[model samples]
Target: MSTTKIGWIGLGTMGIPMSQQLISAGYPVTVYNRSKDKEATLKKQGADTAATPAALFQQTDVMIIMVTDDNAINEIFTGKEGLLSAGVNGKIIINMSTVSPSISKEMAALCKEQGNRYLDAPVSGSVKQAETAQLVIMAGGDAAIFEQVKPVLDKMSKMATHVGDVGAGNVAKLAINTLLSIHTQGLAEAVLLAKQNGIEAATLMELLNNGALASPYMKIKGDAILADNYKAAFSLKNIAKDLRLSKDIGLSTPIGEAALKTFGAAEHEFGNDDLIAVKKYLDK
Candidate 1:
C-alpha cells in the first residue's frame, strides 16, 4: 500500500460513496463499519476492510471520520483500541461529522495533547454532492495542518475553505444550518398553506419550481412532501437536534426560538421521519 493510503471509518450513505472516490483515486482505503453487509460494494470497488477502527488507523497516514453525530464520533475515537490507541502522532484526524462546537473543542484539545492534529470540517452537501466530490467544505484548524492534509480533503470536496480555529468550523456550520432550518421550515409552511386552501400540493410545487421562489433543495423537499416519502435525505430527528443545539446559542433571539419550536412541532407531527417532512407539520 502507498504511504498515502487513507483510512476511512464509517460507510453509510455519504461515507460509502466518498470513500469510493478516494479508493478509485488510487488511495488504498481500508474501511471499518459496524455492519459489514453495507460495505460489500466498497470491497468490490477495490477497498479493504479492517476488523476494527484501530486496525484501520494502523494502515493509513490520515484518518477521516464521517459518522452521524457527536456520540458516534466519541464512540469511534474512544472505541476499544480506537484512534487514541493508534497514537495520532504524525497523523491528522479530519472529523466530517456535524456536531456541537463544545464537542469539537474537547476533541481538538485531546488530539493536540496527544501530538495529533484535528480538523473540524463539517460538510454542506447531500449524498449526491459527496458522490461527485462537489461538497462545500467548511474547515477549521491550524493553517499548517490544513495545508498538510489539503490534497486529501481536495479529493473529497470541490471547495474547501478554512474558517478559523478548530471549533470555529462548527460555529460556521451552525450558522449555515440555522438558515437552512428557516428555509426548510418556511417552505414547509408555505406548502401547507396551499394544501389547506384546497390547492393541489403537486401543482403548487410545480408552479413554484418554475417561479422565482424555486430553489433546488425546495424542489427536492416538495417532491418528498408530494410523495409522502420522507426517507432521510436529512432526518427530521436531526433537524430537531440541530435546532435544540442552536437554541442554546441564544434563547433571546425570538426568531431562532420560533424556528426551534417550529421544527419541534415538525418532529412531533412527523414522528422522527425524514427531516423534509417538516412541511407536514405546517399542513397539520
Candidate 2:
C-alpha cells in the first residue's frame, strides 16, 4: 500500500468513483461527507471515515475536494468544523470541483496563509470517465507541488496537466465547459431541425457521428438523445451554472451568449436531467 495519507471530501456521483480509484490504487484514504451514509461504500473498501472536514484534514497529508457548487466549496473550507478550523500546516488541498476562478484564488490564498498548499484541479469528462479512471485533470498551482501529487492524481485520471498558477484550472475548466455547452446545444438544434424536416433522429445522428463532426462525446450524447435517456450524467442545471460562471469570467461572445440563454431557459424544466435534455426543451 502507498504511504501517502489522503483525505477526500464529497461523495457525489463523480466523487464516489474518483476517490475509489485512489483507494483501489492502495493509497490509505479517509473520507468525509456531509451525508454520513455516503461513507459506507468507501469504508467497505477498507477506507477510514472522518467525522468532519477538520478531522479528515488532521488525519491526512493531502485533501481532495469534489463537491457541488461554490457554496459547498465555501462550506467545506470555512464553515464550522471545516478543514481550516483545525489550524493545520504542511498539508495540500486539491479542489476538483467546478467553481469560479475567484473562489479558487481566494481559497488558495487562504490555504497559503495557513502554510498549506492548494491546487484548483477541476476535471473534464463525466461520471463514466471517472468510473473508468479516464478523467482528464486540468490543474493550476505550483509546478513542484503538482509534480508531487501527480502520481496520486494519476490513479484517478488518464491525464493531469498543470496549466498555470492557482485558479488557472478553474478558468480552463470553465472555458471547456462553455464550449461543451455550445457543442451540446448545437447538436440538439441540429437533431431538432432534422426531426422537424421529416428526417429521423437516428439518421441525422448517424451522419453526424460518421461525418467530419464525429467525436466520442457526439456518439455518447447522441446515443442518449436517441434513447431519450436524459438521466443526468452531467446535469442540465450544472451546465447552466457553468455558463453563468463563464459569463462572470468575461464570456460574452455571440455563440456563448446564445448558449447561455438557451441552457438557462432549459434549466427551468430539465435542470435535474441530462444536459442533452435541451433537445426536449427545444422540441417543445
lDDT of 2 by residue, 160-265 (tens): 9999999899999999999999999999999989988999989998999899999999999999988989999999999999999999999989999999999999
**Candidate 1 C-alpha lDDT tens digits along 199-241:** 9888899999999988988888888888889888667877777
lDDT of 2 at 73: 91
lDDT of 2 at 194: 90
Model 2: residues with Cα > 4 Å off, grouped in runs: none
Q: What is residue 244's positional error in candidate 2, in angstroms?
A: 0.7
Itemize residue pairs with steric clashes in candidate 2: none
Which window of 10 residues has the lowest lDDT sum in candidate 1? 245-254
